[model samples]
Target: MSSSETRPDQPVITGATRLYAIVGDPIAQAKSPAVYNALLAAAGRNAVLVPWLLSTADFDAGLRGLLRAGNVDGLVFTYPHKQAALPFADVVHSRARQVGATNALRRRLDGRWEADMFDGVGLVRALEDVGTSPGGRTIWLVGAGGAGGAIAFALAEAGASQIHLTDVEADKATGIAVSVAKAFPGVIVSLAPPSLETVSILINATPVGLSDADGLPVALDDALPASLTVVDIVPREATRLLDLARASGCRTVGGAAMVAGQAAAVLDYFGETAA
Candidate 1:
């Protein structure tokens, strides 16, 4: 579909009606609809950012339908479905496979769905926005789950000298550390708790700040050096951890920056220039 075209009233779906969706469970919390829809509108695109709230049990059927839908321009995979969406892609980006997740899907010229993960790249872009490069920095990443794993790998690729991964499940954290170390053997890797010392950049990948979640992702009571750069992947306007970081005189980056970067990247995949 052309960017300027509008859908007909009570009309049939066709190849001309281009579509896009962000798949997740309990998708009501997602800001993708607001973020991407704004970008699409600014770019004068006919696309819409619809939410596909699919359960794990419904993943296969939902994905098949998306692939078969001729108007589906692309998709943004989120939350629990990041890993689940990997196998459906005809071409998986190397970074996505190594991180074991994907957040973007593009329709190839040959009519095959190609998958790519933008979380890590977006995280690095967010970090750079705060005036720090992951390269040559000692980093500590909390939460080795899907988002954490992607962020860790992205940090390694961006030149982090050493990365210490930590999670409630030590194995999950350490397992990712192993994969990252193998991917970049020159970088030091290990599992450990969050510490202000020796960490130039700290990332929180857990959902600790989300509504109805437990305490801060990290212990905020402890003193953090002013040299530390804190990045939290929580989209709230101002998270408690971010507040603490501000109070401690540390440079801070928000989840919204990551959201912005991802939205810009996804629009690029949709063959539209970001506004």
Candidate 2:
């Protein structure tokens, strides 16, 4: 059947289909299954992506069990597990190595596993799609966790002149800055409190905008500069930050863009091991 005609309720999974899963503690909120299933169908691949809700205690055993299933070809890792999943991989890509996290994994022909991270790369691609390039731009990035750190590294790699990282945990931001500075000697990387002044781009990689009750990542009394570009990686169609940025006359990129950009890279990675 053509991809356009395929319904989510009627996905043609069977005994011969190859299986892939996205693992997370609270898996219900993940958009991976719907996004990936459509991609697989569009690519004419006989594979399915499912969600596996696993707690911290069961993660290792559950993942090992999945890997042992001959039909399971790969797994995607999410919150509370991206870093933990790294040790299980036989090979770690340079990007994941630098970020100290892995968001996707694929099985190789030799029965070994390879892992890589796409969070930063995906955000960069999303920015580029909208005609914004990090090259020579000054960026103030908040939240130096897995996603934020990956993005800081990517921006530096993409030729950003300067990056100021900050998080609730000062050490996490400092650590990410140290790694980025070491990796890109020419780029200026430092840790600082979040601010909008003198920065061409502002990014919030935190969970602050996930709910209406959540506070803004950065305080704003009035409108921001029209020249500023704001981005939030909260995986929502319209986050409070994005809404505020729009009202303030600043250009904005929402979480959906980041997800869409990463979805392509993720599906391509999965296809490499498709049965």
lDDT of 2 by residue, 27-91 (tens): 77677788778778877788888989989999899988988999888888877688889989999
Clashing pairs in 2: none
Candidate 2 regions off by >4 Å?
Answer: 1-11
lDDT of 1 by residue, 1-275 (tens): 22436632222334455678999886777777778877777766767778889998999998888889877879998877888899999899897899888898888777778888889888999899889999899998888877899899989999999898989888888788999999999899978664677889888898777774456786655567889998888776677778778889999988888999988987787673212
| TM-score of each model, paired residue for residue | 0.88, 0.92
Collision pairs in model 1 = 3-46, 135-159
**Candidate 2: TM-score?**
0.92
The per-prediction CA RMSD against the true structure, in angstroms, equals: 5.3, 3.1
The window of 10 residues in a row where model 2 has the poorest summed lDDT is 1-10
